[model samples]
Target: MARVPTDSPARRPFMTAVKVMLYAALLGLIGLAVAVSITYSQLPSYQTLTKTNDLGQTIRMRAANGQVLVSMGPSVGKWIPYDRIPQAMRSAMIAVEDKRFRSHIGVDPIGIARSAKVRLETGRFSQGGSTITQQLARNIFLTNSRTFGRKIKEAVVALALELKFSKNQILELYLNRVYFGGGAYGIDAASTRFFGHGAERLSLGEAAIIAGLVKAPSNYSPTADVEAARGRSSVVLQSMVNNGFVSADVAAGVSPAEVKIQKMTRQNNVRYFTDWALPQLDTLIDETSEPIDVWTTLDPTMQVAADQAIGRNTPGGAQGALVALDRDGAVRAMVGGRDYVDSIYNRSTQAQRQPGSAFKLFVYLAALESGMKPTDTLVDEPVTINGWSPRNSTRTNLGPVSLREAFARSINTISAKIGQQLGFSTIADMARRFGITGEISTYPSMVLGTSDVRLIDMTRAFASVSNRGVAVMPYGIRKVVSANGRVLYQHDAAEERVLVAPWVAAEMTDLLQSAVLTGTGRAAQIGRPVAGKTGTTSSNKDGWFIGFSSGITTGVWMGRDDARAIAGLQGGTAPARAFHDFMVKAVANRPVEQFETQVPMPDWQLEPGEEAWGAGDNAVEPVLDENGQPFDQDPYVYNPDATAPAPPDPNQQPPSQLPEVSVPPVRQQQPTDPSRRPAPAGSEPADDPSQSGADLAQ
Candidate 1:
């Protein structure tokens, strides 16, 4: 082997192996160059697209009167110039997030190597080596998948960002794109949340505290754990000292005691009102396929007053709702419940219960349309109909009373009688015409509020009456505007005629005014003329006091969700008290007004032994023959005097000899039943012939 030939057969194999190794090295270098060229050619032009074309950013927003009602996600951060950020905050963010942020070209090789070493030692990936530019790239353009493919995409996007934007621009983007806890998505929001100021106004210590929260937001949340937050903040301060961002003397003097972590209060201002009003706005604007800012008619002062009144006057475990609408049915204020956060139920619009005596407005209207005058006499005695006897809430009869007095007192018996006299179908028709969508039964018991009606409908009905019988649909929003300040939708009061006569409306208002002045609605009496009614359902299960002035109409309700009776609660006590307390402040500086006046009544005189009926009958009439003619028979005779003789009971007579009368004429005599007679006027016998003759002979 010492003098081996250059072309020996045994050495030929070794020479061939060395030639093969050289050729493989040359081919590998050529393939690497081609791969690099291909990869560079495939890189996307992300630098040309400053904004991504993604649909994930679309948000549904609701606003009222140009003010935000609710935002589903964090607000988008407004871009600030790099100089607007405080130097201390900027340096602190760099020290904690990316120490070589300014020096790196989007990727930090030293950070990656150190993180890889730490991961290897810990046998798990605990630390991330993403530079600030890389984080901005990922947040703005890349998916959040923790895989090699996504990491590659993030790296490519970061490199593209560095090539397109300057160092200051990249830093500003990173500062605005980061997430801080408590619904904050940028440094500006974080600054305001932590110190109640802007990011540019943050002190060095406050800036460090906010910067420290990026590592673990929940652990360092000033709201969740104050002590842990202080510890984390101290570490950030030490980092600032170590990096020469802050002086050693300054860092030492900055004690944890000096760190003022302001406790965030739950934003209780109009949270519930905004929640309830947003869906309404959505319905009003969704058809246009545009974003809208709803301008409502709500007065903030009235809303606050209503809320305070409900909170103070309502009993424990008892919830209350109040709605105040202007004369045009524009909702001025609404209190859904005590705490909307605790219960999302909007009792003012959602809850439906028997309106109790408050429903008598429709009944009285029916009576008025049936030609019953407000001064007409009605007996408030215990009456039975088809084995169903309705008793007044007072449990005692006031004997004979005028329609005005009976209505003012909200007597159940009189209401039932009037409803029956006018026909239950007529009352049901009236309720329907008044925009009451609740199911109303034909039964006489419905006169006493056996029908369930929502507070919204009831308030709207009252608003109609306050508007002088012009029924207007209740609406919360006045107009909706787009983000660019264009009108997308509008709402105005739509009116319709529901009452037959303006005089009837005036009479009803008079009766309700009597209720506020001298009846159960005394608590709701204001300095001005107010017409209202107090209603309590059976067993006090529901309490309601709905009233109105010339300017506003308010309705209040108090009850439990379970329909359980609140002990010692009534409309006049809690609901009326709340209404009064609220309206006192709500109507402040508003002019006083009087309700419309009643129609004049004609004066008339009756002779001795003569009884004047309510425009229906003068006396009881006898039955008639079936041939459509009156008969001279004993049982078929007409009697005008009660002392003359007692009329034979028609049911006891034989069928063949029984007399028949016209249905319309017979309806008049039914009101003269001995059990349903009105009390004598001035203590004189109204129908007795013997007593009348004695008074006349005197």
Candidate 2:
């Protein structure tokens, strides 16, 4: 009775279970093989991982003087080799993320168990269990998707990386490619973005804060909330202490206030210019793995001045944009809005708003091109074409006026008549030749700027005139250099494009100068020989002022994004005033420039031809109010006690030749080099922030 038979019922049941398990194992292997076959093309090649591990090139946009305007791309600030990466930054990351990083092959079972236990005790996940190598594998060759297949890929890739690379190489890869926060990918960029310096200079406390951000970048972003970020930093420091990376006293020595949080708004404003400039890179160079330096035409001084002008002078609730271009078409300063934070939709480049009177420049240029002189007699009377009638703001037209006088006065009837005579297609072609882009519709009322245009295009068109009729396409990039400072592409300014005859620009200048001196653009006069035109559309939905002096052309536009009317807003008030303010600061340090040998302002048109060309009772247009609407009564009368400068005396004669603008008292700033910048508080001498972009070029 003691011996059990080998083929008993219990043994048979065990054998059946073994067969079922074998079949399940076979099916699982078959399923895995099928999965591999289906997804092989999408999966990264593990053997090629080492060769393709080059970190993403960080695109650093810098002003002319090398002040970094903004940075974008896969990686942050700069690439740091494992050796150059500050010891504290590496230590803090290891202590907080994977204490057993040195001993683990690819995964850390001990760390995972610790994390799971802590989760059970706290009823919440308190720590990450993935080793630094696993993270590097995910960052380098895998997506962040959470799935069984993705996890398997991460593990397999991590093992392959550990086999091919050392602990330091894995750490360096992780540090350089990890996403920190706020558009920053690596330590270098995150450090500069948050602390205004490079990662190499991070202090103990700063390193701790950066290490803490991996868990929740947005929540711990110092820019968004400093106190919360400081709390996270403390936790990182305490973890470092527990892991023996730092002593308890040394950990406590790091102060919370030592973390200086720079506001992102001020620095982020330049993104408007960078955003406009970045897309142009696609046309300039093909995408490459090596980093590149985009040396833009941005002048730091001019940029600051332009920003101040728009911020201070733009009418509240109405947005304003400014674009300044050198005669050669290099963009000096671009402020795309009153505040970029309020709107990222670039008003200078993206917004296709009605140019209003600004488009009149195109009309006048076409008029001059068509053999019409500034002195040609043009009647400022009512005119209608295709049942479309044009009337001046005064609603009454002058009996007879010189082309110069009509232009200066911004008389609507004369421009409409000229557009009809010149043909809308002629004006449209003229605009295109002057580098105006996008659809410039050949509508009857296009002469008065009914067709929409970008401020940059308008500015570029004006720049052609400023360049003595030589054509210019407004450009922001001056040169794109390699990370090693090798020039990739440079703008060939010598390849001149003559859009208009020199004589035509001269005639246009004379008319534009008189407009500032004795017509609608009176507010634009800044004690300089300014030449500009004022544009105001029906219902005053948009206002624009574009002009050029000292070989630098600037255009300003004011309007709402919704195309709603800004009460009384006109080119002569806020837009012109902003232009005046920017110019006052922009050209303060540059030498005064001559307008070439141009024709004189017309005094005979006022007196000698008084009978034929009516001696208008109003020599200059009335001063517009804040919203740019005309004053009912002539209110520009001289007031000695006025805080504002009194209006020019109508009885007094203007000079035969326009005078060059006198320099103001403002001081120009040298281009900033962050490498030369004094080390900020709690920072050390490491890689220069200015050189970070160049350093990461590879």
The backbone clash count of each candidate, in order, is 2, 6
lDDT of 1 by residue, 105-223 (tens): 88899999988998899997798988988888787667677898878667776776677678887887667667676556678877777777788787888888888888787678665
lDDT by residue (tens digit), candidate 2, 346-449: 88888887676667788888898787866567776767777676656554455666677677767677887888898989999988887777887776767767
| Model 2: lowest-lDDT 10 consecutive positions | 679-688
Off-target runs (Cα >4 Å) in candidate 2 are 1-54, 71-268, 597-698
Each model's TM-score? 0.54, 0.58
What is the lDDT of every predicted structure here? 0.70, 0.74
